[model samples]
Target: MSGNRLYLSVSLLLSVGYFWLGWSLMQPEPKHNFTPCLFKNVTGIACPSCGTTRSVLLITKGHLQEAALTNPLGLLAAIIMLTLPAWLLYDFFRREKTFYNNYSIAERFINKNKKIIIPITVSLMLGNWIWNICKGL
Candidate 1:
């Protein structure tokens, strides 16, 4: 297969894996062994993306409150998990990369709003970090 098709196939596989993970975690007792987050293990603190897997599984199983409690990013991730495969499949069949073509717009927006964007980004990140710390995750 061509490079684009190869990438799409890999993407599909990853999506399926994540979905399977979510399904497995939904069980009364998860049978899989989980590796602790490396950052959390070394630092004694939850990393920005820590709890993401649990959160995704929770959200997929319709446990939104639990998902948010696990990780705020989980909500965003769930949305992406739901959408990205369809997006990739659409692009694959079209034989064009629509997702990659939108970068210039984002770049222009960032360049125009750096002063406003930087502080907001920092605040959100710091706030989320504090929340994670408070949760003792």
Candidate 2:
């Protein structure tokens, strides 16, 4: 069936992607003191994605306050980035041939709350950023 092929394809792609990502992470990352932000030339305000790497680095160094100062959202983003690949792999593996044919209630939550959830997530991130900036002062 088409669904089965789709599942298999996704699994294969995720497997390859996970392999590449692990390989890349094992290698040494670049050292750049200057921060990079696309909005630097435009609005001059650091975009929402700015300071992401600094936040990640700070988090890894166990500097929670510094990580949050750099970007609270970025720290959360880093957590998601770290877990997403594993989640994708899990999902990919389970999707095959109806391996997880009966989806759980938790999985059903995704389709049930999109309208309210999205705006709430945006508001929470914005609030977190504002709180972080205020806390820095």
Candidate 3:
């Protein structure tokens, strides 16, 4: 598949996964964990993203504070999950490469600021991991 098609396919799949998660969450009692963190399973400690799924679900239910407490990364993930697919669809329908262009711009910006961005990102992730551990997620 072409790069654009690949991007679209992945985005659509993620959207479907989110829908499934929502459906599962609506059940009186969910029998399965849709998202299992491998790191947590192996290490017996919550990973930085361990609670992201719950966080995203809370966000969908309009519980912003609860979502934040679950995992701040979920807020970023939810934003991407909601916006990326729509942006990709718009680009596909309009025969535009706006998404790709923006992705390239972001890549360049990150590369240009890696020295600063990398440290900040690592620090944030470490902090989040500590938070997850303390929360017993």
Candidate 4:
């Protein structure tokens, strides 16, 4: 898809996700485990993203330390979820494509540096998975 459409679609999806998160928080916690992770369900092992939801919830509640302890990726996710929509909307209203342009630049950089970037990304994910397992997430 084109950059504008991609941005708009992502922004809307993220907004809806945030709204669902908020709504879930308002309800009472479920009695049984209702995790959304199929990998975890089948394997009985915490995936790299196991605690991300709890981490993001803690982040929304302003518990930065807890959120980080839960999952460092949540901090990154929170930053993107919180800021991206506003930036996308701003660009959309102004008929600008700065975010898309930057995204393209980043994509090109990552593609060019894949030999370096891919290994690092994989290592980080593996590290996170190890951390999650150790923490019994």
| lDDT winner | 4
Maximum-TM-score candidate: 4
Return the candidate ranking by TM-score, descending: 4, 3, 1, 2
Q: Report the candidate with higher TM-score, 2 versus 3.
A: 3
TM-score (C-alpha) between model 1 and the true structure:
0.72
RMSD of each predicted structure: 4.5, 5.8, 2.9, 1.5
For residue 56, give model 2's deviation from the true position in Å: 0.1
Give lDDT: candidate 2, residue 69. 79
Clash-forming residue pairs, model 3: none
Residues 29-97 of candidate 4 have per-residue lDDT tens digits of 679877788999999999999888788889878999999999999998888887888888788899999
Tens-digit per-residue lDDT, 50-112, candidate 1: 777778887767999999998898888778777777777777788877654544567779989
- TM-scores of all predicted structures: 0.72, 0.52, 0.83, 0.91
Q: What ranking of all candidate models by lDDT puts the best one first?
A: 4, 3, 1, 2
For candidate 2, write residues 57-101 as lDDT tens digits.
667678999888777765675676666556556666666433234
Q: What overall lDDT goes with each candidate model?
A: 0.75, 0.60, 0.84, 0.88
Model 4 bad stretches (over 4 Å): none
Which pairs clash in model 4? none
Q: What are the runs in model 1 whose C-alpha is more than 4 Å off?
A: 1-35
